[model samples]
Target chain A: MKIRALALALGVAASGAVSAAGEVEVLHWWTSGGEAAALNVLKDDLSSKGVSWADMPVAGGGGESAMTVLRARVTSNNAPTAAQMLGYDILDWGKQGAAADLNAVAAKEGWDAVVPAALQNFAKHDGKWISAPVNVHSTNWVWANKAIFDELGLSAPINFDELVATLEAIKKAGYTPLAHGGQAWQEATIFDSVVLATGGVGFYRKALVDLDADALGSDTMKTVFDRMAILRSYVDDNFSGRDWNLASAMVIEKKAGMQIMGDWAKGEFLNAGQKPGDDFMCFRFPGTSGAVTFNSDQFMMFKVGSDRRDAQNQLASSIMAPSFQSAFNVVKGSVPARTDVSDADFDACGKKGMRDLASANANNTLLGSLAHGHAAPASVKNAMYDVITAHFNGEYSSADAVSELVAAVDAAK
Target chain B: MSQKWWQQQLPKLVLSPSFALVLFFVYGFILYTGYLSFTDSRMFPSNELVGFANYEKLFALRHWKIAITNLGIFGGLYIGICLVLGLMLAIFLDQKIRGEGVLRPIYLYPMALSFIVTGTAWKWFLDPGIGVEQIVQSWGYTDFEFRWIKDRTMAIYCIVIAGVWQTSGFVMAMFLAGLRGIDGEIMKAARVDGASSVQLYRRIIIPMLRPIFLSAFVVLAHMAIKSYDLVIALTNGGPGRATELPATFMYSYTFTRNQMGVGATSAMVMLMTIAAIIVPYLYSELKGSKKS
Candidate 1:
């Protein structure tokens, strides 16, 4: 019934043009406040090119449910034109040869020169472009309330020691030093960044990304767990089941000093009409500023009939275009996927993200985020999440947690 | 003879489609799920058989243990509370009370709402920052606190509370029906014997409602095992897997985490758990009927 209603509405909106040209039916889970606005950029871009978009917006936060729907649709041989996928999920679909060959669009757009290699790796399957890169979201970011920071005469922490000191001072000032949500994914988000901060980018990759037993069970990993415990201690009793945005709201209201979250939390600040660098300060999670943990949101085009292939091409071109990339990522609270896109209108935090991303890219320090499905497969990442969150919740000691991580990753592998 | 045969065949013909649907979709799928439990499936189903490897892994995970522990806590509390409440309400309404017709519907109304709705409403009502805690604090009781939904140790109780709220009324209706079916002559005789109202219930009425209790237990036990949406909306097995149940674990593993084998194993375990409760009850029911 909902599908019929949507089709009827699309038919009315299209009138004669849909049959004249082709329609792009994009399946995604970008229905939140800021996410919706950002998605309109891609929609309007396609519309400007005489292509119609049949919006199939599934409104799950993490797109996990959307992937289930997509899998069923594909198995039924009625795949959508495109779907919003992350990291190896795109590759997973590509391995099935379910995604389209977008080399036609890629060659025309000079994507090889423009799109980042890291994003391109997942977008390509067997050396063929199957998806279009949209934006880069670095997960290891700390959003601090500038008001609280200034009142306390503190700067953003430069290391784990400094971060602890800053948090202690924030606690002394009688504030939630670290605003946190108690969900598994939220806990893993903090752990992902903490992995980078505790060890350098190399250690983060070896342990989290590669599931290395030596790195996972080492004393360094134990200290990472210790730091995680310290971070957990800073949260209040009311923190469980709290939405990530609400945690961001704590920083927005100056009730909390800092939030360890992805760049997407900027949307909450933006929604609250708070400007970055003025109302808040954005930095890489302490000791990890030099590196970036990235997860790119890519739209994988599916194999549609010849009739709608033109619309798919139009979508690919529009999405890959520098102007739309800038416009979309600006609203999407992510940096542009294109390295060459100008950061002129980007906010202070956005500029920092762009600069850090470029430097990380140059220095080979850009690692994919585990919580957001960039570093490992879903099974391995979820295993790590179980261990990480269980440890974070005090189900295991730091050493036990480290050993459990090794066992979990090994079992999943 | 032809006319009689045609009339008899018509009912079977009318029911065949639904019966076939139930057989193939329900029972057939169960067998298929059983098969998948033994295979090495992930992200998508596969043909590779791994014997009981998935089940072994599923049992070893700490999260799975936590999920089972939560189920025990939730299921026990949910069933115990609902049964007691339902019995009490049935007794209250059975006393030739005023506006019984009006009151019965009020009691059963919560059963009409989906657990999702019940959960979301209760989530708001129980969450510390925005629910009762915040409301009470705002009312000048600044030290007042209610954070059970957020507390790892107590989060499962919040689910139990919501589950009972949605289901106790249904249990009440079942008991009420059971009460109405009781012979009025027995109650009159008990009254003549100088039995108190409480004694009448304790000695005769309650014991007579055994079948109703059994039926309610089976229903509630199945619901407790399959408690997914309520948990999802209430805590989503969160505050670090504190409220995780087998159903939610099965879903997250199969769909979200792409560990379909472990998920199927969990599903099989849940099916066995539910079957263990229901099969014997069904056998006794059928055997008793046959004996009669």
Candidate 2:
């Protein structure tokens, strides 16, 4: 009986390998509760089209480990059908001729008319579409516990000074003024808004996006560091090594007044069974109202053999479908990548995000976030992380941080 | 004649596949990485040789500097503490104490766990709000403070604490084996010659355990040098890169930061450091064994 079972297993494996025609291997980093559910929407859509999904989840928050695995797979001549990539990384792969051109599918699906230009910049390389963007994650939003603000009789602060005063009020109420994770990326996320608030969108583009030495070393950058220092004082002593979701939980639990993070934090609040407008509130980081610092999640298709090309194209088209984008982004706590998607099914925060994104795109205030690998290349982003984290941790003063920022960016370039 | 040749070549034939695999995968990759270090590689390997520019850039990086400094502090404290603690435990166990078998396994159990588990456990245990500090506070000691893991300057010491906690047990086992291997006759002779317990250990037993000490040092030193997962699990080289080490730096640069050339350069430097330690020890051991 055992011998028979072994023979059957081997025969099944052999047939499985022979029948691996319609399988699409998707490498992604969305393993969190909401994120996993969000990805399932796409998986089910692809599966419905008779294309099997071979899920390759690498669970780093920043998709760093996924990129690492993707590079290894590419180098070994066994690239996945598609890899969930971010800004700059997609173009980097496209430049290396590793990504498969998706212009044929993209044109057929009219993706150019639907997807936002900011996202399209990452989706295309050399006038050919190589990827499909899924969602837009704006990093300048602050999630606050509405109860705490109501009890303290404090409203949302609209500028830097008022924000400081509100934090003081929250501290006086004996709550953690700011819920912040001490990780480098989290610190840099806060810095993204702080830079925008301090110097406006043009200066942010100059200092971070353009890697300008003059803007980076100017007094404006020094003032940005000073404001960062103020934020550092508001964080709790136990903030070190904490994850961003835990920081979000602080606000949700009413132990903290607010947390300055991306829209992804909204997922945490929703996961905790809390309603957005009732239990919590979402607002742009003060003085960053008109500007949206954004990062879009894009799935860059890798060059694969003709046997799997049809399935890969199916996956690309499914990712760009308006229905799939709305369904996925509603659960993902991010706005849909497609501009034509309706906000009727979205909750309060989601609707606001859609409105803000549309307005920001029209006004050309939609800047790529430096913290989220959209403003610059990975090298420059990491360099900025080093300086910003150091400054936030009080290792460097405002003056030292400005000079170090300029030097670090230059060295990275 | 054919049967005789087959028998003579059996061991060589059996070992050749593994030997070839090791040579290609280990040494071949090492040489490849060394070559990549000289090139202008980023995100992926490239053949454009930039010659020593990556090395210059690496040395000038503040992150690299902090990583090196942290390695020194972490490696020194981890190895030193483990040695002292391991020696004490082994000597204590060497005494004809009751339940030696039970105590031995209890101490050695930590060694069975991966550094990742040890690091995570220690991270929670050392965290201020959740672990020791809270536990102490709940015990009515509100003024108690044990937040070293959260502090910038003192976070590296927390890594040393966790690393020593995990590895000292294995080192203790090594020392205990060495102690058991010591000839009973020499110990008896020393005792009969009016040697006290302290003198017996300090002057005779410890002097004879020099080889064990050397072995333990070599083992602990390499573990300290390549400690990536432990640092990652504990502080993640954070609280502002205060606990960054070379291994973590190499990984972040090569994979995450898109600075593969600098990463390879860091890796080569680390390899040289390990070689600087291990080559001399290996030569001495081989020479000493040959003489014996």
Candidate 3:
């Protein structure tokens, strides 16, 4: 009798497990404090819909490690239900036919109409919705300590010359002019803004995104390198191997005047309990106000079992919801990916980011950031990183840098 | 079956599963990587072989050239310094000093820490702002500067320093054991013959530790070739690829840069380099044991 009872109980447990709400395994690199908090909002949203979340978090700043993990997972046919991917990596994965077709949920939720064309370019692969973009992070922003600017009597610089003058003034006053990390990505991030500022949107598109030989090796490219060299002089000697957040902390503590970083740097400032307009100021990198170099974080759905399709769709739809978009990006320090989302909940910097993104989009200046893996494929981007970083470190002259850039891009291609 | 046959067969049976696993996982993956090096695999492995195209590209890359050069400097300095320092420490410890037991563990403690931990701790210690330079400056020598970790030319040496610090202790243990195993009668006879300690070590004791030296070289050479975590935790092959080694280049190319073919090529090169060192050593060791 006891044996029969035990077997009956085991049978009941098995059926209960099978009939429970399906699971959505999400792989992401958003493991930082603010990022984790933002991710929790989505996790809770999914949980409310009777789907359990299997978190596969890989903690690397650039999502490089996460991409490696995702590749291994997909190659082994154990792909996560959803993965937080960025830029060309999404399209690359989609091209492999590993990404699920999310046209059903996307069309239902009208993702085509809401997501920006720039984002949609990556979100859709071969006319099928493959990823749901979460937020748009623009790289051409300068975060400044407002107190230093106020005390130094320096207004926001309007152009490259004025920006250089401001950095000189700040240096003359004995503060490190630029709070910058010496890492390759950080240097490349600065390069993104410098290129946009030096040659405007068209040249940036030609030189970085299109990888045009003439434009890359042109005298204008040499001028960009010269400006980069000038900017390099303003950085502190101890900047080598420093993390990006530590650079942000320099600005927060008034040790440096400004930092050229993505919108994510604002998270560090905000996390330090500083208000946007009062304590710190966010402005477009000089001369890049009308243009934005952007990379988006998107949750890409992977092809999975038929029984879990409903949960996958639910996760996709939830990610694209305007409510989640606004709430998540508010904490994530990036503007919402959706075009129609209101900026009422955003802080001063968030408001500025939304305004700049919209204007850049409307003006056809919404270029993808090469530094953040939006403009080029990983091979080309990394090749570019090598030259840009080398140039920043004074390893090459301006003319040599331009030629090297051309050569590197051609070789990588 | 005979009792002897059962004993031998049982041992083989007990080891076969692990041996098979090692063969399939290690050698099999190595062969697969060698095959992948010939293909145009990017992001994912593609079966389409490109016939030495990846090798040509790998050779053409300035980054790979820099990585190879850095490896030479790091490997040479790391091995040379570690062997010297380790021998000196072992010789000192072998003098029957007070608290030898306590001192021995202290010397070997760094080996117990992972390369990652050693790299990170040394990275902080070598940084200009918060480490040796700052401490020196605070001591009224305001002009003191130790920013090699930031200097591209000097950054590779910083890696060598960290590598040496981590492995020299283990190397010391090897040398100390070798020193201890040297028959005391030989040392006494040398002392009675009016030979100084330096002469005794140079002419006799050092020559007797040839196998230990070879073993140490083999160990350090392989460690230097496979040094990824330490470099990653330290300079991250940065200040503009100055500290890049083949291992880091292999990883960034394969995983980050989407140049899996080039990464595989680099990996195969590393494998060949390690084999060049290990194979002959293994052969001689086995041959020597057989003769004995």
Candidate 4:
């Protein structure tokens, strides 16, 4: 009888231990220095909460390969507990019933109030929250070496004409005016800046967001193409095939005048021991200061069986918690998705991003970054990639490129 | 009677695991992918039927056009150059010259490398700034430009060059085997008739390599149809979609673009094309063999 009682006690202990050690596998493409650093906050928090993290990182900028792995796992009924998703993917996957409905967890944590409206829209399917947004990335920022500008007696260009003159001046001084990476994504980033710079914020919304045919073929788009032709002159001859971080390195070393990239380039600068405002400057590309092109990285929880759902809820609550938002974004080199989160630990550039994000959110200047998977379907995005890259390589005439772009969108539809 | 039945079925039972693997991994996956082509799936498999909508997009994209065009250019050049060069190398090596053993190993070593490693080395050698162009410029041949990999029209040929470097050795080995199989009496007659080296090879030996030629043709054609890794690693279908192949196009559509339906359709199209060519040729070869 005593032995039977001991076995029952041990059974209870084993069941309790099992409940405490639920392991969650997270799949993401955040292998870069800053990205990994940011991911550690969540890892550390999860560990502190007695949850184990099985980290699966796939190294690719595009995140397509990781999505492939995620889909395969889901199809095999072995999906990861959570995965990194972007833009419409939350809705896209949620609609397919691949994502777990986080409504109960969200209500318990009051996630609706903390998370931004735009992000919540993307994260929800039929008003049910399915994903947790991590941070906001603004894609139209132009990073410049402050030392180069100071040494050359130049200031940040505030308009299209001034920006052109600045680029010309930088070139005449024998420095490459643009430290541009020649990847398709980087080229598209430059194009996004061009569109906003030439056409202003409203046109970007109409053409890119709404996919308005007349807006796409407007004289505004022609101006954008023309400016791209000019911007081409600022890049070095051997810019093709250069990685984005390498381009950032050029700016960090003051070898080139500027690089038009997303806010993520700040991480590269920070890694090089360069502080913002002292060594470099971040500003929206000249004529695009009033516009904000944005893409977000969100962590989406998948539907596991009931036993692990509680652990998933705990992580979701931690993600939306104010403390985690601040800590994660400070390391991530991005602004926290929560507007109310403190930017105390943020650097000068990050603080600027926070201020800009708030203002953009308030003023309705937030445009989605198409190439980075916010504005269009993947088919339309890839079609645009082909035409834009072809045009950049000088293989297509402006007229030819415009026609192809329109045709590609129609075909994509 | 039961023991006899067990013994009769033992070999089949023992090999069942491998047969099951082949059925599932090869044929089952192929059918699954074909079924996926008919659906309007994105990010995850959806049962929404969109019936050839994806294929319509694949054909409409300019990058797809460039990929199909590049396949033709690279496929023809790679096979033609590798076959001719491999035959010449095999013939020369068969002369029983000194150091033949060492040279043969050297030729075959390239076939052992992963395309990723080979592509990196090739990219460095072909880079406009750091490669042949730089070396020539340093040597005061300022006008000597080797920028074929950078040139949009000629980038596909650059992939062909890399392909020959990798595969010519294998082809040489095949031709070498074919050459060794020739009867000694034919060479004796050729020498007695005072046939030159070129005349003997062109007239007699070339005709004798018919079976080897057919085998090599099929192997090369299969390689061309499924070429992906080399293009991905080397040019990444770049210089603005100038060096894309059908396989890479299918990969990007299925994986990168998340347009699985389109990707699946392209795969089916590629499979059908291969079937159309290979089925008839294989049938004719089998018939010819039977007649012999």
Fraction of true contacts retained by every candidate, in order, equals 0.90, 0.85, 0.85, 0.56
What CAPRI class is candidate 4? medium
Distance from true location, Cα of B23 in model 1, Å: 2.1
Chain B vs. true chain B: TM-score per candidate: 0.95, 0.98, 0.97, 0.93
Q: Which stretches of candidate 2 lie over 4 Å from their true place?
A: A1-21
In angstroms, the error of model 4 at A113 is 3.1
Measured against the true structure, the TM-scores of the candidates, in listed sequence, are: 0.95, 0.96, 0.97, 0.95
Using DockQ, give the best candidate's number. Answer: 3
lDDT string, candidate 1, A1-413, tens digits = 99999999999986747754578888999997788888888877777767888889888888987999999999999999999999989888888878899998799779988776777788899999999889999999999999999999999889988999999999999999999988788898998888888888889888887778899999999998999999999987788778899999999999999999999999999989998888999988888878888999989999999988888888888888899989998888899988999998798899999998888887889889988889899999888888888888888899899888899899888
Question: Could you tell me the fnat of model 3?
Answer: 0.85
Model 4 clash count equals: 0
By summed lDDT, the worst window of 10 consecutive residues in model 4 chain A runs over A14-23
Candidate 4: residue A306 Cα off by (Å)? 2.4
Cα lDDT computed for each candidate against the true fold: 0.90, 0.92, 0.92, 0.84
User: Candidate 2's residue-wise lDDT over A1-413, tens digit each?
Assistant: 99999988998876533344488999999998778999999988876777788889999788888888888899899999999999999999999999898989988989888777877888899999999898999999999999999999999899999999999999999999999999999999999999999999999999888888999999999999999999999999999889998999999989999999999999899889999888999999999998899999989998899888988898888888889989999999899998889999899999999998988888989999999999999999999899899888889989999999889999999
The 10 consecutive residues of candidate 3 chain B with the worst lDDT sum are B233-242
Q: Model 4, stretches more than 4 Å misplaced?
A: A1-21, B2-8, B46-57, B140-143
lDDT of 4 by residue, A82-133 (tens): 8998987777788778889899988887877766666677888888888888
In candidate 2, which residue pairs get closer than 3 Å at backbone N, Cα or C atoms, i.e. clash? none
For candidate 2, lDDT tens digit of each residue in B1-292? 6999999999999999999999999999999999999999998899999999999999999999999999999889988999999999999999999999899999999999998999999999999888999999999999999999988999999999999889899999999999999999999998899999999999998888899989999998888889999999999998988899999999999999999999999999999999999999999999999999
